[model samples]
Target: MQMLMYQECIDACFDCMVACNSCYDACLKEDDVKMMADCIRTDRECADICALAIKAMQSNSPFAKQICALCAEICEACGEECQKHSHHDHCRRCAEACFRCAEVCRRMAA
Candidate 1:
C-alpha cells in the first residue's frame, strides 16, 4: 500500500507527545517546580493535541488539516516555553522535538 498522506506529521506528533511527557515529569522533579508550572501545563496541552491530531490524520478526517494546524500552534507555544529554561536537558530536548513536530504539522496542514 502507498504510504499514508501526512505520515511525517503523524510520526512527529507521536514523538513530540513522548518528549512532552518526559519534560513534564522532569519539570515536576526540579527544585524550583513553581517556575515550571506554565511549562508543565503547556507540555500536557501540547501532548494531548498531538495525540488527537495523529488520530485525525490517520483516519483522514475532514478536520485533519484543522487538527494539524492547531497542533502546530500548540507545539510552537510549548517549544517556546521549554526554550525559556534550556539549562534543563529535558526541556532542551522537548523544545527540539516540539519545533520539529511543529514544522511537519504546518507542512501537513498546508
Candidate 2:
C-alpha cells in the first residue's frame, strides 16, 4: 500500500500508457489504416489498462496486485502486437515500453 514501494511499477505504467497512445495516433496516420486495425485496437486497450493500473496502485487499492497481473498480460499482448510492426519507430518504441512495463508489473504482482 505504500506509494514509494510501487514507484517503479507506477512509472513503468505511465511510460507504457504514453507509448501506447503515441502508437495509436501513429497507426491511425499510417497509409493503410485498415491493416493496422488490430494494432490500433490493442494500443488503445493497453493504454487504458496501464492507466487503470496506475490508478489502482496510486489509490492503494486492495486489488492492485490483481490489476498488475492483468496489466502484465495486456502489456505482453500489446508488446507482441507492436513488435509485429517494429519497422515503424513509434511501434518499436511502444513495443519496448510495453515489454518493460510488463516486466515491472509482473514484479509488482509477485
Task: Please state every model's RMSD to the true fold in angstroms.
Answer: 1.2, 0.8
lDDT of 2 at 20: 98
- Write candidate 1's Cα lDDT for 1-110 as tens digits: 21267777889999999999999999999999999999999999999999999889877789999999999999999999999999999999999999999999999889
- Candidate 2 pairs with clashing backbones: none
Task: Give me the displacement of residue 109 in model 2, in angstroms.
Answer: 0.3
By how many angstroms RMSD does model 1 differ from the true structure?
Answer: 1.2
Per-residue CA lDDT of candidate 2, range 1-110, in tens? 49999999999999999999999999999999998899999999999999999999999999999999999999999999999999999999999999999999999999
lDDT, candidates in the order shown? 0.94, 0.97
RMSD of 2: 0.8
Error of 2 at 10 (Å): 0.4
The C-alpha TM-scores of every prediction are: 0.96, 0.98
The most accurate candidate by TM-score is 2
